[model samples]
Target: MRDRKIYILLTDTGTVLTRMIRLYTKKNYNHASLSLDSNLEEVYSFGRKRPRNPFIGGFVKEDITNGLLHNAECVIYSCTISQKQYEEIQAFLNEIESHEHSYRYNLLGLFAFMLKKEIRRKNAYFCSEFVATALTKGEIVQLRKPPSFVAPHDFEEVGDFQLEYRGKLASFYHNKNHSYQLSLSS
Candidate 1:
């Protein structure tokens, strides 16, 4: 069986919410998004549904090349997964995307995490929680704690993901005219 790659993007968007999160997590990148492709065409996360409003957030297909993530500093990591795992992830994302309106950002869950508690909402997730849950549901990785308890830094501890790129999100764009390769592995 062949293997496929999935990208995990950890970013610091410098938003008020992210800044607040940083005060607690003390992590450089406070947000996490999962990308199905290296080019980041299929990035999914639970974040600001609108660039101007962080409160009205939910299952969002982020545009890393524009809006909040464009100027953000990020770390990209890639993990190898079996074809079956890829399909499982795709199916899970597709199901949620199909009912995206029902989903909402798990703001309460995010707060509960600070106190070492988990809040299992019906259809909601914070950024890292969403990514962690998706990866777990795909059978790509098993986390020591629940997804709600997972933070951006925990991804590194739990998975065999290789560091791929580290720089401004704008520089990471893959286009015809330009490309950036600040490979940490090299």
Candidate 2:
């Protein structure tokens, strides 16, 4: 048996960046992240480099709460993956993190998406794009659409994932002592 876990975090960050994405996407959650850990304390995504600026973004280690997303609302989805698959995910993410500075946010790709088009770049990614890529690279999910075309809501459509929690991002921590029926392996 494999001792590996994966989580997808969908958040309505309520930031200017999120609001802008929501305005165009018309979706409840405008940001997406993937975490190797169940607690979602260590999540990865491409997002705003500066808290106040929506334009400049890049690969990032996301926080489910505190800082920019402290007051955000979120839904967490959990999935169990095989050891080999999990290793692939870790390797892919490790590569990205190892040369993170070489990556940037794909603004043109995002704009193309708004127009129902796709414009992929070698070293750039957006929120959902990165998450989709991670899942595909890990072989945890097979996407019908390309990673660049994925939206935050798209993760919700993956039947393999189970909804673990849905509430304010901070509330989960406060209610952690209670039985929430979610677990992750270290």
Q: Which has the greatest TM-score?
A: 1
Model 2 stretches astray by more than 4 angstroms: 177-186
**TM-score (all chains, Cα) for each model:** 0.94, 0.92
RMSD of each: 1.8, 3.1
Predicted candidate 1 versus true structure: per-residue lDDT over 125-148, tens digit per residue:
999999988998998887888999
The true-versus-predicted C-alpha distance at residue 68 of model 1, in Å, is 0.7
lDDT: worst 10-residue window of model 1: 174-183
In candidate 2, position 104 carries an lDDT of: 98
Candidate 2 TM-score to native: 0.92
- Positional deviation of 179 in candidate 2, in angstroms? 8.6
Which number leads on lDDT?
Answer: 1
Lowest-lDDT window of 10 residues in candidate 2?
177-186
lDDT, candidates in the order shown:
0.88, 0.85
